[model samples]
Target: MQSKSGTQKIIMHIDMDAFFASVEKALNPVLQNKAVIVIGAQTRSVVACPSYEARALGVHTAMPVYQAKGIAPNATFIHGNFGKYRTFSEAFFEILYNYSELIEPRSLDEAYIDVSHLVTSMKAAHALAKEIQNTIQKQLHLSVSIGIASNKVCAKVASDLRKPGGITIVHPGQEKCFLSELPVEYLPGIGKRTKEILNQLNIFHIEQIANMPEKLLIEAFGRTGSAIRAFASGEDFRNVEKPEESKSVSRSKTLEEDTLNTHLIHAEVFRLLEECSLQLRQEKRNCDTVAVTVRFSDFYTISKQKKLNFTSNIEKELWPTTTTLLQKAMHIHKPIRMLGVTLENLYKTSQISLFDYPFSKVKNIQQAIDKIRKYFGFEAIQTGRTFQKV
Candidate 1:
């Protein structure tokens, strides 16, 4: 079968298992085969990822640590270093791009590759997967699971059936049989609520939806239901694409409850600044602008931004700038429901200088802070702003 451009295609989904925990294990071999969970400093913090050993103990991504502790009391926990994860992720994608031009990064841990023109057979595709996995293991010391198929849906599902370092291939002619027996929940976009509705209709298997009458499915799920049916039948026509240059880097959170406290709002802005600054550094880009978005209890929204003289990825510098933008946008009209901080006007920088700071003293102090944060963990070194937030 040909894509809209009349090009035959083979698609592959590559996924890293419990990426954060796995990377920690790779860096410290002693952590291997031990239950591990990556989290932030807050007990209310969510689990970023859990190793397979932790998963067996009922630990899962996004579970609060207190719950995770109950599930895996003996598990080791690590506050993840996003800088390290992003570095490895970027290098991993570079290797993939060497083999195919059409690559889609779904997240920091998984991506899809369209290698139709590069390879001609299922056997060849399997060989390429092995080579990719081997290269990653050798170069990055991480394991990746790969699934090869004719389309995105099948490849995505196949990638998840088996955990780390496994490969599954779905031949073009066998897509239907390969996907039919799986549960409806296996299809993306069908969340817990939708699955309940489908289960009520006795349509638990993907094949049930594939064969459902279009009119009834549409009546039950609207246009989305029709799309899901097509997906179940292996009809995804989307093409794999490279990760787009980010238009903006942002951070936001749904508050536990609405509040009008300006101090709390300021604290939230600083936290966001820390995350955005790190993201900019990881992407090797600097921002010349800062923007703030706010949502109010009455659902009113407003935004404001400031153009900067130059971009820097130091949180201490960026936080103050971002705080000014947020203050301008906040009028205290209603309790705030959410807060957002963003960086834009991104440009790559290649030069590194130890003399950028005014006088040698400032530069030396900055270097000391960087070293402390790197070796002792980011939380080990914090600015006054972070303490005030606490």
Candidate 2:
């Protein structure tokens, strides 16, 4: 079916079936037909993915391994290898390009393709979807679910309707009807908190959301109300866009052993902040917001951040903020399993003021240090904090 854009677009969403768990099963034949879960349950890691068999037993993503055991006691839990998954994803995209080159990768396990130019009729699109789905299942031994619709929102929702290996198609005129019976929570951006708010308004179904008075919705949800209303009406005008440059730089480390040692945690934080700072400089970007995240041994995670008065890519200037954020995040004195730092609110190097730094000597030193690390390796340089081990 044609969109309101009048045959200008046909969006298709492809989602891999139990991506991580399936990858493990594909590599190890003995894992086939078993209720397999990828990601170690012993540490702070959560269940990355569960096979269809495991899902039937109520195991799900983000469920802690400790808890998932209660549901699938016999399921095989594995520590997933991402390098292999990336190799599989690279091959997966190569196959997708054979169908349509206008592909937008949503993640390593999913992508969207604009097939308007390749197929005029819905019948042709369905035929091609089945063709690509079968090709992946046969070639890589992986199954994918596909959703075809007039717009991306509808296509994305359709794709998730069926799991493992199923395909669903929504005609242009049927978008509103198809969504009408779905819960408000099914809308793309609506979360648990948003659902609670919508419920207070006596709204539960997508149809109710579509029919809400525009002025009332705007009053209740501010600008967000208008956007979701358009989405409920299946009027998403977004094109399948290409990936752009990263807006933030970040680095994280999961400790080999979960520890309560403050000194060790502090050192790792400095290392992450240093690594993240180097990335910002490499990209020739400056950031005004610095954030620190701490994942506790029990898997409770907390993040704290603050805006700096001036943008910077230098670790020396960034450290105080990272330290303060780490302090705030660790106020509970919880045993830490991971430490992370992120630089955001980025600005281009060209846009920075020449006199942004009161002392130009610091900037000159930082540039030289980055060059040494780039040429002689990170070990060639040592920040005093990094030299210590608790």
Candidate 3:
């Protein structure tokens, strides 16, 4: 398909297929082709990702492990290793940087590459994608799906059209035809509710919306109507962008049962705070502000925050501050259904010292313990607090 002006905007979207689960498989080669699910070791944790084999049985990310197990009973579940995943992601991006500076990494496993400047020929783009895919599979043992198109939106959609170890190339002038054939829901950002609303208006496929009357569409959808109409027609003008460093890290969980028990509430709060701090450390970030949120059984929610004098990601230091906020926001008589902890006001350098306090010796010992765990693995040592659970 030739463009009207005979020039194409070459863009490619590459996404690792089932990234977390695939990483687990890569580390443990014996798990290849086996149904796998990545979850937290904690029984209450949610499934983060499911391999395609497990997905076939209706298992999916964000599902509770209990629910996922009910569906894919024979599937093997492994706790996620975020450290290893991040290392692999960084290496992948380092390789991407060699190809083009106009690359946008959407996540640890998804990125958009504007290769128009680098590879003028479609054949070269296809060949380059093959080489990149092979490199990842060989170096990382991870398969990826790549889509090439004239714009970012179509390229992203085309990438997902083909699953695990596949590529779809939509040459210029064919995007409209290619996109029109897809369901409106297939376009990004159209969620279940939006689909229902569009269906009510007899707008089932993208083709229908592309040709829909602009005035009537605007009256129905407000400000979003023009964007949606243009999107359906493959008129996306969004550019690939290099993402900024994360400014905050947080963790939250919903309890299966609304509980008024103080012990259980505190346990959940500590769990969230520990998880959030671990995430911040993984990103090499430290927080000076700690915030907590509590939602009651009736859905009323309250949040409180405290700013510390120094930045910290140490659980021992952060938990007390978070728990104090939790204590104030929660009423023991009310059954709380959800809890969240956020660490903000991130510090880029290890500029703050924990040794300034009068209790510096104790803090030093804790830091030593954390460093040991960081290198030797968490299972190498356990505190009396964790030992009680065992």
Best by TM-score: 1
Against the reference, the lDDT scores of all candidates come to 0.82, 0.85, 0.81
Model 2 stretches with alpha carbons more than 4 Å out: 1-8, 40-42, 247-250, 256-390
RMSD of 3: 4.4
Decide which is better by TM-score, 1 or 3: 1
Name model 1 segments beyond 4 Å from true. Answer: 3-7, 252-278, 281-288, 293-304, 308-320, 326-339, 345-390
**lDDT of each residue in 66-101, candidate 1, tens digit only:** 899988889998987765676677778889888888
TM-score of 3: 0.79
- Which candidate number has the best lDDT? 2
Better of 1 and 2 by TM-score: 1
**How many Å off is the CA of 367 in candidate 3?**
8.2
The CA lDDT at 280 in model 2 is 77
By summed lDDT, the worst window of 10 consecutive residues in model 2 runs over: 350-359
For model 3, what is the alpha-carbon lDDT of residue 156? 88
Each candidate: how many clashes? 0, 0, 0
Candidate 3 lDDT, tens digit per residue, 10-53? 88999999999998888788999899999975556889999999
